[model samples]
Target: MSTVEACEAAQTCWFSCRAAALGGQTWTDGPLHWIREGAEQNLMFPTRIPADAVQSAVEEARETGVQIIGAWLGTEVDASALAAAGFERGWAPSWMAAPVADVGVSDDPRVELQEESNDYSDEYADYAEMLKLTRVRPQHTWYAAAYVEPGKAASRKLAGPRFAGRAWSHLTGETAGVFDMNVWPRFQRRGIGSGLLRAVVAAAAQAGARDAVLNATTEGRLLYETCGFRQIGAGITWWLHLEA
Candidate 1:
């Protein structure tokens, strides 16, 4: 498979995992994978173009009063197809990938810890609070936080938010997906983001992932490139509003 295909597959796995963790459901119909966490959190990923599944989903959403967000995996799918299906183009994120072996570890003064679990409420809270302090809104529900301390301090008082990110690996697979990597505004340029990224990548590597993939924001693109990740393609999400 092409690199974009591999990355998109890994991302689909990540979305599946997200649905499971958030008490949702996932299923596949033809080349489209559907993930639904709630009425407000329905998403579709099209792995192939000319997918009649998109039109069918739009019809279903119209009847159910639900919103459908379609994520176009790679360049193969034309934008007009989604437009025809009544989806409006939204933000585009860069698809990136790198071999796990090529991703180097960070040696910043702060201690890093990576946690993989179905629930990340505590970490998510810290991540959300950091974003709040920085006047940025938190975008994801799962997160790992990197704090600055003399050592692996056990108390929150002894450490502060340096960096935070989220990642998930497919079961019985070699691909992992990284998401929502962020450095607290006060900690930017301190190498903490690298430390946090390395920790997340290492966790996925330990979980049998040979390659790491992620959708990077324009602002975070340089940081990921510095960590040996290259842009393989780009993905755009289109929204279909059936909710009334």
Candidate 2:
């Protein structure tokens, strides 16, 4: 899938060019946004950045509620400068993909991967439980904050009596997508995760998405492989915070 398309599907994530959107004229929504007030030039040329230019964009983003959130690119130019410029390593999560309906899931009978049409708040409780149960996790606190905060990916909203985590599964046209799957310790290894993944594939098939996507972890890898998912690549992120 196109990185741009993936960004739209993922919501919180953005490609390198879209990262420039973070530097718009005004900032709103919340600190979780990737925008910076005067970072357009830097966005255009992330590499070979002038010392003052990089500093200016970083400072501008901080001055407003915008957080750098990091940048994404196809090349090492940005990563190299980001590292030398003091941008810390955000994450190096494994990017995996799977062909729809290729794997067998043993958890088919227990849980049902229904389309959660309700708001994220409705799914918040389940989503939170999933996060808590997620022992093998990404290497950062930012991801933890994501589900807790609204607008960020993994966020959930209240739906009627229960909370629902929304995603491409909720959107029109796109079906094959990943979600925050959670199973309590008491319910561990019972096939909930696999079932949910199956739900994703099923949902995608219904919507026309060719495959399911996710940033998988070590623990989830086996489960995913068992279900026919393959590792697409590794997602390496570089984060820079400009100190005034």
What TM-scores do the predictions have? 0.71, 0.53
lDDT of 2 at 70: 61
Highest TM-score model number: 1
- Candidate 2 C-alpha lDDT tens digits along 198-238: 65456545545565566666776887787887776655556
How many clashing residue pairs appear in each of the predictions shown? 0, 19
Task: List model 1 lDDT by residue over 83-139, tens digit each.
Answer: 877778777878888887788655654634433332247756533333221121222
Most lDDT-accurate candidate? 1
> In model 2, what is the error at residue 205, expressed in angstroms?
1.3
Model 1 residue 70 distance off true place after TM-score fit, in angstroms: 3.0
lDDT against the true structure, per candidate, is 0.62, 0.44
